[model samples]
Target: MNDLVCLLFQSHVKMITPMLLKLFIFASVYQECHGEERVDQPDPHIAEFEGRSVTLQCKYKTTSPQPELFWYIQKENHFPKYMLKRNKYGGEDNDAQFQERFDSNVSSDSVPLTIKNLHVSDSAVYYCVLQPTVTGNTRTLH
Candidate 1:
């Protein structure tokens, strides 16, 4: 009777071991798949005439207490260039080349890019990024 009882216990342990391992792997994958930060650019395409002013909208969600937002511009056949950065704590930095016309203000849920005196050369793809970002695929306009 004792032998039978021992065999049953061993079988139960063997069955549960694999199940526990699978559960652990799943939890790790789930944690990695979900993130606490995201950014949205509602208007994928925007058009404005030369010398006109335009505001590009960017909305973001983050769990961070002090969120920092960034703007990047990618012209045709070139790498993405950093345009500016704005923090929730009233800090800001703008690249020298873009200082004259490019500006943004970080609000509670958004940081909009305002371009004054738009030029033909200003035509390009824009990106809004959040700090501590996750790696993912992004599409660029061709």
Candidate 2:
């Protein structure tokens, strides 16, 4: 009985060892592919007159073929609010509150937020965000 139990345990270990190794390799490759993503807001401060238009620039570096870029606005003492998101494949969505005045286009490496008829309320910090694509299966078995 002791020898039988030992043999079963060794076989189970051998079976699981390859699966663990494969998972480690997959994780490393996933990190290597998705690790170097970043977004840049070139101008920390921008000034514009009321009732005019201003464009805020955001640049990004990503390995995703269909990168999704987003814009957010944050008021004083308030959390960031999602304004819009633009995809490389022409997909986009804008918040109802920003539909009229906020617009953007996704280019090869940058997305610029253009606010028309700027209001005093629009005087807040704007942020550019990047959403990286998921390349592999992300589900876990129970």
TM-score of each: 0.70, 0.72
TM-score of model 2 relative to the true fold? 0.72
- Model 2: lDDT equals 0.73
Error of 1 at 102 (Å): 0.6
TM-score of 1: 0.70
* Per-residue lDDT over 12-129 for candidate 1, one digit per residue giving the tens place of the 0 to 100 score: 2232346555753554464456556667788777776677788889988777777889998766566567999999889999999999999999998999999887777887777787
lDDT agreement of model 1 with the native: 0.71
Clashes in model 1: which pairs?
A: none
Model 1, which residues run further than 4 Å from truth? 1-32, 132-142
Give the C-alpha miss distance for residue 111 in model 2, angstroms. Answer: 0.4
Lowest lDDT sum, 10 consecutive residues, model 1, at 1-10
For residues 6-82, could you state the per-residue lDDT of candidate 2 as single tens digits?
A: 00001122323466557645644755666777677777777776777888888888888878899877665655579
